[model samples]
Target: MISEPDLVKYLPDCQFGVNSATRLRFDFRNSGSGERVRAPWYRPLCRQDFLRPRTAAMEYPLGRHNFLRSNNLEEMQDVLGRIMCPHRLSYLDKPEPLDAVINSFDLGNLVLNYVQYGVPIAVDPGATGDFYALQIPLYGNALVRSGGKTIISTPEIMAVTDPEAPLYMELERSTKLLLVRADWDFANRVLRDLTGGLLPWKLRFDLGLDVSAGRQCQWFTEVVNLVRRADVGGGMLKGPMWVPQLEESMVARLIQLHAHRYSELLATPAMPASQRVFGQVVDKIEAMPEQLHTEGSLASEFDVSSRSLRSAFQRYLETSLFGKLWHVRLHRAHLDLLWATPEETTVPAVAERWGLWEPLFTQRYGENYGETPEQTLRR
Candidate 1:
């Protein structure tokens, strides 16, 4: 990996025109309604639907994070360079009316950036530096060249630029891309942890990434959720604790979904929570069992991912997170049944008080305590 200073020195100025062009803006239909986007953790998206339904001619992706909208190629180069590593920008085709827009948000060591140079442009970032790039086209197709391989990237077929490699991209005018810029150190740490490897090494991904279905689809869903949260101003990723978890979830999914060198070892059953994360989740659950809970909601509240939270509960408590919640609710309901008379309350009432139905309560109670809720109520 090259140092930042050395990388800057080697890269020359971007060569393109400063031609003025039309400007674009974002549309916020339901800005503060609190019901605009109800995104959860990594809900797999339909293979065909890459962008959210809010995407119209008016609504823009990453509209909330928009910081730069310009036509000057030099200014675009400098501005984008400050956020990402320095790179040379040129024209791949006859430059159409140029109107470049950039919106970026940082999550720990990762950055979710939306970039659209409204023309056919070529980007030359000689060596990718110490960062990985997941380039997913939201609108148009692109020619990706890196590490002696070339692939045509589209909405379904994404492109990944490895940390230590020579990379260039020929983007079409219709291209509106969502780039996930990740620091090599932090991302590699996640891969190492997920693989339970002793040492850290640069994990290389294949040139082309297919988000058509399966884990790749799930990974894209997570990426979109992160971008949506940033755009929606949920303050979810703004917290000190959630930033790391956000990065962890993003990189962990890439490691698990994308093909890599040690992908075969991933099936080796990752180790359980060694840190205090498990206790934190347990305390939250035991503290408030009556609250309406979902795996995604609990994970969000605790600044963790749904999958990680589930893994912790499964390994430590010998049950799922919801399974533990069920026991807590059942215990409380059992006490209510024992203390109250039939005139005061019935089996249905006691079960409903704890967010359970009569039959479910009765079945679970019988399984655990060798009796039904009705029997307990009568006693």
Candidate 2:
């Protein structure tokens, strides 16, 4: 478990204070050669193939916790124009020292930023040449305009803009924004992989997202915050071990919550378990309980939607495919335990053979069977 202080070392020019007092600054200029640009903000982030070094003196924050206090509009325009979308900034009132605080986490393909744009400004509209940009204001309000349609973003609502569209914004005072930048190709790939390779030629997202009250919205918010905190706390995302899974989860939630051109295809009612594809899925799971399986992986194997597969299992088996898989593996592990000679086998060894590695497996197995694996072996 990495502490908040432990994360300080990863930030540039970090200083220590008492008890959780950690000051970190990430001057984007200092990180030379385009090695790392904090997403959505750093202009040259996406199209590295067409990289052009900027002569403008731009300084941006990529921080664990830091303040972006700047009054110079040129510097702000340069940073915002390059990193995010190119736009002309207009002050509704004299921009009184833009004091935006940032706590950002970079997860390779996606960048999560908890930023408060502390001043009011009007941004002119032009096509934001990026993949996907999602902005959720935590407080106050912002009017977002795109495709001649306007939506006022508040705490209960979020704006998910397509990269190809022209976007304009009028930010009110103290409007804190949580911005998420995801790669367009990576997002579509996940969707195609999830839906078994059936997708439209072009994917377009609805500009506004209603997250006022719903289970899906709650789950999406929870995971986003969890990932943000985890990244800030322990650098959990810095390693490859859990990054792929976490990124997929985040992207999956976005696809679910936002309405896009192919939303109906994804939301199509699932087929019955009596379907041949569903039966084949169950057969595969039963025959190879130890094989690697996930909702996406299994759906792809049977050339069906993961949602449909899940619904089929729920309708017929009264358990999720994942739940059924767990029981099958457990039953297999039990058989292995029974057959193993006392000197040759241990509970952990048996568990490992069935893809139930210790620590977690022991607890889960105990919960299901009301006894530890060793106790089961003794029987």
Candidate 3:
């Protein structure tokens, strides 16, 4: 077993309190075998402010004895935007190996605990535990490996590890990490619903590190600044409702951006044969409004049998081409009826412009908008 003195030397600056202290007490009870080990631990409490322009002061009490034993960053450009200043204070009498344990907490509950590993730390995985761990690597990369795969994470990339699965990470250099142990049920459900059910089975974020001078880079910077100013100690519920909503939206957008990048990589070229034929047919119909404008003419132009063109259009735009055309024309006619000058814009003129020369326009318009075209024009 590790000794307490060695652990104290490895401890980092105490952010919780100046006088906060840690001491170890032991109790040995005889079970059938020999003796059972028990230790009574108490952690001191402290408070701090985030000090940002946009948000107010957030304060919370925490103890080192309860740090990771209880519950739970990115790039200059990426880093500047994503994290607020994080502080941890601990008081322990001796050194001991940190063990994996089952723990749970509310999703928005704030804590003042920090982990300072003298060497790189590696975490082993377990079953679906109570808490969701949000790992922010402040300094060097934290290499996470699981399920036969590995990811090197830095301040640019943020990792949310599920306590349910086995997980471990090694750091090349000494590293500082912010571990937030949040409720799994709430975090999972909110994330799933907000993402439209497109997120992966696990939670992780790769905040790309390319912080060149650009609009995206600037936006990243703003996000980090916001975090820096945010009151981490203030529980999420006490804050404005918009705070959690905004956070969820930002996470969703980040996922979408990465998904799009992956999609572009997988996209293949369009078929030449299909493109050439479809291009010529669509072009002619769009150019000469007389011949190729109608459904029959469109079918002929495409050299397709009856209903084939409609099927092709459905495949391309998820709607019959003729129906889409009609919709567009009707929408334009409605707009003209609504906004046109009284004298210049009449029911008949609008109908003619939309290829609805007869009473069919009036009937359809009435069905769709609950009023006749003439009534719309008059209004």
**Lowest lDDT 10-residue stretch of candidate 2:** 41-50
lDDT of 3 by residue, 124-216 (tens): 443326544455544456776543446676644555554455556665333444444445554444344432234455543332333223323
Cα lDDT tens digits for candidate 1, 306-337:
55665777678767655676678789888898
The per-model lDDT (C-alpha) reads: 0.66, 0.59, 0.39
Q: List residue ranges in candidate 3 displaced over 4 A.
A: 1-114, 127-134, 160-164, 179-223, 232-240, 260-379
TM-score of 2: 0.60
Please name the candidate that would achieve the greatest TM-score relative to the true structure.
Answer: 1
TM-score of each: 0.62, 0.60, 0.34
RMSD after Cα superposition, model 1: 14.5
Q: After TM-score superposition, what is the CA distance of residue 322 in candidate 1 from its true location, in Å?
A: 12
Q: By lDDT, is 1 or 3 better?
A: 1
Candidate 2: C-alpha lDDT: 0.59
lDDT digits (tens) for residues 1-379 of candidate 2: 1122222322212222221122111223212264543222112011222122232222332343333445555566655555555779778897566654455555766767655445788877477665677777655688998766799987657787766778888888656677777778778766876566657565567888876545445434444444334433432233343355457656766786677767777677656534687789988989987665666667777777666776787787766665677678878887777777668888866765665544556666777778877877776
